[model samples]
Target: MAVTSVIASEASLFLTPQSIIFDEKSRSQAVHVVNRGNRTGVFAIRWIDHTMTEEGRLFTWKEPDKSPWSLQPYVRYSPRRVTLRPGESQLVRIALKKPYDQVPIGEYFSHLNVVMLNKNVEESIRQQEEGSEEAEAGVFRVVARTGISIPVLWRHTRDQPAAEVEISQWNSSQQTLSLQVKRLGQVSTRGFLHVIYQQNGKEKRLLDPHPLVIYPNIDGRKVNLSLANRALAGGKLYVYYSADKEHWDKPLGFASIQL
Candidate 1:
């Protein structure tokens, strides 16, 4: 009988300040990337543009040549590639090439992607080819190159937008809540969502700090959140959209529904 064993390897990378925002006052920004894995990590960084659907699905911008809303054209980054050892860190600096006024009065956004190279995977493959006894015993290895993308947005000085939240739909059987964040005014707004379940006299938080973004081109975004394994009978659900993840005291939008 041949015994099979599977080994999985992945890169451990951490990023600080999940999102980046640039306005007239700020000229540049920095993103910190740390390697938490024991092995050295090689990463490639670049800017990518994406469009969001009503259901909050991201797709690469199809019309790159005519994508007026893309922020890639005006933005620049440093250190396109880097090699980080364990407990090492690198800073990726971003700056705008064009003046703030030169841009149109709207929100432009793109994603900064940090992708891990498969150097470790190649090493593993080379080792397996050396013919160890464990390899003869049917040892299979699977390696993954993980990557992260963060939204980077730049808004004109005159562009200001407001957001409002509404409960679009609900499914009791599926324990799901659907919401639409409506955008009003010129620019777009990005923030986080918090869902609270109030039953009897006690309250339970169902969703804490989910990303919410409504671009300038779109009227609103549809977000569906699942509330599985949580008691929702005879309760009132409150949803709040806040400017940042740290504080919910002042919400940009608020909505509630009774079950």
Candidate 2:
């Protein structure tokens, strides 16, 4: 009998705001997770209150309606157990609840934990007592710890207006796509351009550009997208933007051109 050693790679979780702006109503925050490991890993996370006092810092756990721990208010698990096969990565969505006119104007903090479950702990212990030929019984067990900080800012209302996106032009000869965007109001916007086309009622993504950052007051910025050697036979082109990658808005601007 041969034994294989199992080890966990460095795993981490982070929120875009690190600090967030919360209105009276409930608002959601986006979190990105990176799995830098050869095997799949699982994570368990919850939000705990961390209040800053004159002396130093005081931590309190919040218990929401339904969760794993009583002290933790909101607990979430990745929808599916993430299986990362050598350099694979994934993202998870988390929602933060803020009751109307409840929280005061200040900085609030919370913690998140990424854990890996041990699958071979019992087997390892049993093998050790049997005097197996293998020198060591190799132990695999679930590991968990808490060490992530989530900072949030409370505000009354949204300060800026939503952003607008459009597809300016499409060049079939050159196999390139051009995009133009206008800032309707003033809100720091970040999103990517996703081009989807339909053929025989079957939808497929034509080109996905890297997420672009649009600052306030920037009238129209052009993003060059390459669509070379792609199947664009008979389909309509659609372009749109989104605050979160998972959810995308309707086609603000579009053009029907053939390649």
Candidate 3:
């Protein structure tokens, strides 16, 4: 019997167009993945259905009963596996194919996961036979695999979705504000959350706009944002959630609280 082990190296991967959306009219999209690290990386691309917790944590949904919002059955991606050298890039094309007549109409969600596998099988076998110096030095070389994920959403129609965000609670001692974002329609909403502090007719941004999303499966999510002490003294805080710059005039929702 023979045993083999390979030293694992981390790869710095960058993905463009972080979030993808597929509509009734457009059913295909491509994502660009780049390996920024010096070592060569092998990635396995796949789809994973996820559920977001109230506190903004994502967990894989693998129960016997599938979620109504799961996009697993309808989505497909090309180049399930790939090997890239440093500074190399690959485009993963994703397509959606749903039996619209059978499935319910709404938004579906899934995550595209890029996972790094063990590197250089031949080199590991050679090292094992040679009893490498690192092995003589008693230094353990463990294979550590890592991955990156991005959301891929699909909708049956092009109709606009809406959601409402309100300041649910404030922790003065901790300088944190809890926001309750409630989904209003059957579709999901993705946008930016802007927090503004207005005092005596003057307004200033408390924090850089935060990326916000409300998926269809869940009714609402709670997001906690930290506020600077100076901004909380004697002003009114206003929060606005808008899908994008083009839809600024028609914001999804807004709420305010006086400090």
Best by TM-score: 3
Instruction: Write model 3 residue lDDT over 28-68, tens digit each, in one string.
Output: 89998888876677888887787776666777778514777
> How many clashes (backbone N, Cα, C below 3 Å) per candidate?
0, 6, 0
The better candidate by TM-score, 1 or 3, is 3
* Highest lDDT against the true fold, candidate: 1
Question: Looking at model 3, which ten-residue stretch has the lowest summed lDDT?
Answer: 117-126
Span of ten consecutive residues with least summed lDDT in model 1: 118-127
The C-alpha stretches of model 2 lying farther than 4 A from their native spots are: 1-19, 22-161, 249-259
Per-residue error (Å), model 1, residue 135: 16
Question: In candidate 1, what are the lDDT values of residues 1-259, reduced to their tens digit?
Answer: 9999954444467888898888878879999988777666788898778777777777787666466788888888999998887778999999988666676677788889898875354455667788666667888667576798888888865656567899989888888988888987767777799898888889777876898888766789988899887756877999988887866668878899999
TM-scores of the candidates in the order shown: 0.74, 0.40, 0.80
Deviation (Å) of 52 in candidate 3:
1.5
Give lDDT for model 1: 0.80
Summarize candidate 2's per-residue lDDT along 1-259 as a digit string, tens digits: 9999966544433334444444446455555555454434444444444432222234454443332222133323344344333444556555544343463332223444434442233444566788656455564544445344554333334554355555667787777777666645434344566766767778777665456544332444567788888846666776666555544544333344444
In model 3, pairs of residues that clash are none
Q: At residue 131, give the lDDT of candidate 1.
A: 62
